[model samples]
Target: MKKTIFLFAILLFISCKKEETKNESLYPEAEKSAEEKQLELGQAIFEGKGNCFSCHKPDQKIIGPSIQEIAVMYKEKNGDMVAFLKGKAEPIVDPSQYEVMKTNFAITKNLPEEELKALEAYFYSFAK
Candidate 1:
């Protein structure tokens, strides 16, 4: 009976984890001033420090979707991209591509709010 109870608890935990992962990319909200600055910083980080541009880009897909495409999806979902940087959000948009992104998962699994926000801004900036 204890074994059965433990299994049930594990399933419950997995279910909750999936839900939390789905919403990982969202931010609380953003002010215009902060967003602009974050975006600029994000661009530098993504292209330079993050090295995301190798697999991803502002307007075209490399190994991953373009930043503009990501922005469009984020806008539609009304979700937070920040969660993604923290390894929270799942690859719902492109499950097949998850394998390609999996390698970078460890690096982005834990990021500061500022860095994630800046990355979001950088990605969203390409939508225009």
Candidate 2:
């Protein structure tokens, strides 16, 4: 029984390892889309009126975190990122870091819904 269990575990490890290596090669066209063009508009809001560039960049971390990291957290949380923006959902990634963002959300609270949608799309587009 012990030997069988060890063999099963080894097989599982190898299967999971193979999956990890194949992940990036699985998609190509989705990386660039008309939806991504909208991100350019969203990116402007993020950097300008939203002033998100003060804390975030496309690939780096600042006082908060990167947009890429947010995209990963959004996928893992299994919920709409917009709901989180509306205060309808709790933080699932780096909640300690969220506390810092908490100080700023009130400013974001007044943003128009369309703008919020654009922002959500903008952040998620990084996942592409």
Candidate 3:
């Protein structure tokens, strides 16, 4: 009887531990702050539909300037990032690459206002 009880106790502990871990992993998005959620959405767009990752990286230059560089350049311009994404503003970080970016504007210019804001917020978050 004692051995059975010990085994049951061990099983219960294992079950509870598994449940705890499962819950932690299951609802990670629910636990994220608003900024985190925005960043996640922005990242998804950047990597998925926006296709910005093809030419712009978070920290390094590729075919275009890095996200960090754009963020810093626009941080003082007040809404210029959103304007650029919306095709309302000209490229300021690297005008030499503007043609490449302009060709991609069709993809970004039509984004929903909320997504544009979120993408801007995400880029600005990287500014230093």
Candidate 4:
């Protein structure tokens, strides 16, 4: 009985290892490019701590402008999103919404530069 249990345990461990290897090959996390990683970081911030999804959505406008609109306008104007997030530049998409957005600056302005850049990259990902 002891030998049988040991064998089953060994088989289970081996199977788990094989499954992990297969999943790793399929996902290939290490193969992700810098831009992909940046996008992911930005997405996380947008959906998570940034609470951006509460206002700015990916497509249509919600409380503020849509992500696509912001991206398109920024690209056309060559605006620096990072600067705007950092509270250095003024809002260009919807100045009327600045007061509402200003309340979030306390959260955004405190974020690290890398995180801010990642947010910009994420936003631009929706650009046409």
The local distance difference test score of each candidate is 0.77, 0.78, 0.86, 0.94
Q: Looking at candidate 4, what is the lDDT of residue 123?
A: 98
Q: Which number leads on TM-score?
A: 4
Q: Tell me the lDDT of candidate 2.
A: 0.78
Residue 59, model 1: lDDT of 74
Give the worst 10-residue stretch by lDDT in candidate 1: 23-32
lDDT of 3 by residue, 1-128 (tens): 99999999999999999989867786787767898889888988989999889998999998988889889988776547778877888778888878888987798888998888888888888898
Superposition error at 15 for model 1 (Å) = 57
Taking every candidate in turn, the Cα RMSD to the unseen true structure, in Å, is 16.7, 9.5, 8.4, 10.7
How many residue pairs clash in all the candidates, one count each? 5, 0, 0, 0
Best by lDDT: 4
Return whichever of 1 and 3 wins on lDDT. 3
Off by over 4 Å in 3: 1-26
lDDT over C-alpha atoms for residue 28 of model 4? 81
| Candidate 4: pairs in clash | none
Q: Using Cα atoms with residue i matched to residue i, what is each candidate's TM-score against the true structure?
A: 0.66, 0.65, 0.74, 0.79
Candidate 2 lDDT, 36-55, residue by residue in tens: 65777678789888788898
The better candidate by lDDT, 3 or 4, is: 4
lDDT string for model 1 (3-77, tens) is 999999999999999878666746624424676667778878887868898988767877898878888887878
